[model samples]
Target: MILLAAHGSPDRRAQALARGLRKGLERVLGVEVLLGFIEHQSPTLLESTLELGRRGGGVVRKRLL
Candidate 1:
């Protein structure tokens, strides 16, 4: 699994970009990919990391931007 940590934005364009990147990552990695926000969005790093840890049996990687 991969955790993508990004600075969240209220703008629709920014959210769309992030969503696209997340999709691309999921397609490329062939594993579960989780999206998270450092700010301005839900499912923050701490929450997502904990959830990923609970899922088990997968490597957790992060991409920050």
Candidate 2:
């Protein structure tokens, strides 16, 4: 699993960019890609990490942008 940590933004374009990156990564990596926000969004970093841990044991990598 991969966790994409992005700065949350109220701007629609920024949000769309983040989502686009996630989708692109999902296609290229061929693994489950999840989104987490540092601020101003739901399913924060802590929440996403916890969910990953709950899913199972695996090496989870995180990318920040």
Candidate 3:
């Protein structure tokens, strides 16, 4: 699983950019890329990580942007 960790933003434009990035990554990887924000968004970093961990053992690479 790929975990995209970001600082996040309250601005609409920035959020849009994040969405685009997630989509592009998912397309390239052919796997779901989950989004987790360090701040200013639902499903914080810890929450997302834990949820993914529950899916069983695997390497989760975090890409920050």
Q: Which candidate, 2 or 3, has the higher lDDT?
A: 2
- For candidate 3, the lDDT comes to 0.77
TM-score leader: 2
lDDT of 3 by residue, 1-65 (tens): 67788787888777778779989989998988777888888578888788778876344666555
TM-score of 2: 0.82
From the highest TM-score down, the ranking of the candidates is 2, 3, 1
Residue 33 Cα positional deviation in candidate 1, in Å, after optimal superposition: 0.6
Error of 1 at 65 (Å): 4.3
What is the Å distance of residue 58 in model 3 from its true position? 4.3
lDDT (10s digit) by residue, model 1, range 1-65: 88787787877788788879989988997977888777777788678778878888355555554
Stretches of candidate 3 off by over 4 Å are 57-64
All models, RMSD in angstroms = 1.9, 1.7, 1.7
Residues 1-65, model 2: lDDT tens digits: 88787878878788788889989989998988888888877678788878878887345555555
Model 2 misplaced stretches (Cα beyond 4 Å): 57-64
Clashing pairs in 1: none
Give per-model TM-scores: 0.79, 0.82, 0.81
Model 1 TM-score, 2 decimals = 0.79
Worst 10 residues of 3 by lDDT: 56-65
- Model 3, residue 33: distance off in Å is 0.7
